[model samples]
Target: MSIQVGDRLPEVVLKRIHEGIESVDTRALFDGRKAVLFAVPGAFTPTCSEKHLPGFVEHFQQFRDKGIEVACMAVNDPFVMQAWAKSQHVPEGMMMLSDGNGDFTRALGLELDASAYGMGLRSKRFALYAEDGVVKQLHVEAPGEYKVSSAEYLLESL
Candidate 1:
């Protein structure tokens, strides 16, 4: 089953893009704080590029103001995720985590087989609100749907 509210996030090493690629632990990110962790099926897709990412980019400050650390995770490599961040002009404060091998994705039970769509194993579109390593809210979208996972809705849910 997919992760649910009140479930502790699995300890997984997510790749992060910086000057060099860094492996970050999931627990280190969420421990002792509130955070918004949202995932997309792939980077640079139409909806994800035009809407999903920008929504978070636009509201990042507000999320920060509320003391919530926001990060975007995808099933791409660090290079691609970093390139997408640069293309979108994403702020430095927001993290672009790469689940390069889909380890974290599978651990969360949110992996989607998108070979038909040209992408292989990937994360389903979802948004998670976690506090101190435990989830407080989880929103998984229906296939090809974007309603519940947008940043605006996350703000409302928060």
Candidate 2:
């Protein structure tokens, strides 16, 4: 079953690009905080690069102002995620987390199989608002749809 409001996010390790090599615990990222976590199919893809990620990047400050931490996840390597964040001009305070092995995605029961497109296992586009590691709301997009996971949707939900 898909994760829902009131669910505690699973514990998973994610690779992060920091000063050197750094691994982050997914639960630790959300523990004791309100956070908006969004997942995309891949990094550097057209919609993700042009719209999905930019929407969050543009509204990151507003999210923080509302006392929420914002994070983006993709089933790509840390190096690729880092490059994509730089290319998208991600501001400080927004985290671009790499679910490189898809462990986190699977743990959330949100993994998408896109092998037909040669993308392998990926994440469905979705957003979640969580408080102290428990989800408060979830917005999961229908396949090929982008209506629900946008920054506007998240802001309104908040």
Candidate 3:
């Protein structure tokens, strides 16, 4: 089953590209933190570009002011995620993570088989609010839908 409120995230090492690629364990990252962990199907796709990512980038500070760490995840490789983040001007407070092998996404049961779209093994668009590694709220979009997981929606929930 997919993750639900009160569920602690599964253990997985996600990649973050900096001067070089580095792996961050999800359990470690979420420990003792209230974080908004969001996933996109792919970086630079239309919705992710125009709405999803920009929403988070724009509201990152508000989240931080509320004592929440914000992170964005994609099924793309670390390089692509880094490049996309630069192009979008993702703030320092927001993390850009890559689930390159789909391990984290699959582990969350949110993997999307996008072979029909030629993207392959992407993540579904979703956002979850986690407190000290336990899920507090989860906003998972229906296929092709965009209403639930946006930053505005998540902010309202918070």
Candidate 4:
């Protein structure tokens, strides 16, 4: 089943290119703070690059001002995520997470099979708000739609 409000985020390790491809544990990352984790189907895709990530990068301060840490996740490897972040000028503290194996995406039941489009297993466009590891809000976009999970929408909903 897909994760819902009130569900605790599953235990999973996601990667990021910090010093050198650091591993981040979900529980440790969200256990003591409020955080917004937004997932993209793939990094550098049209919609993802043109709109999705830019919105988050633009409004990253607002979320932080409200005491929430923001993270962007994708099924791509940490190297791709790092390149995308640099190209987009993503803020320093905003995390770029890589679910390379799709393990975390499957664990959340949010995996998307985009094989027909030449992309293999991936994550749906979705965002969730969690406090101390418990989900408080989840915005999962319909297939091929981008509305609820947008940074503006998530900000207003908060």
Instruction: Report the Cα lDDT for residue 85, model 2.
Output: 92
| CA-lDDT, candidates in order | 0.94, 0.93, 0.93, 0.97
For candidate 1, the per-residue lDDT at 155 reads 98
Give the per-residue Cα lDDT of candidate 3 at 12. Answer: 98
Tell me model 1's lDDT, rounded to 2 decimals: 0.94
The list of candidate 4 runs beyond 4 A from truth reads: none
All candidates: TM-score: 0.98, 0.98, 0.98, 0.99
* Model 2 worst lDDT run, 10 consecutive residues: 19-28
TM-score of 3: 0.98
- What shift in Å separates residue 134 of candidate 1 from its native position after superposition? 0.4
Model 1 — which ten-residue stretch has the worst lDDT?
A: 14-23
- lDDT at 120, model 3: 86
Task: Write candidate 2's Cα lDDT for 108-137 as tens digits.
Answer: 999999999999999999999999999899
**Per-candidate total of colliding backbone pairs:** 0, 0, 0, 0
- Model 3: per-residue lDDT, tens digit, 1-158? 89888898999999998769999999988989999999999998999999999999899989999999999999999999999999999998689999999999998999899999899899999999999999999999999999999999999989
Question: Which residue pairs overlap in candidate 4's backbone?
Answer: none
Q: Tell me the deviation in Å of residue 104 in model 4.
A: 0.5
Q: Is candidate 1 or candidate 2 better by lDDT?
A: 1
**lDDT tens readout by residue for model 4, 16-135:** 999998999999889999999999999999999999999999999999999999999999999999999999999999999999999999999999999999999999999999999999
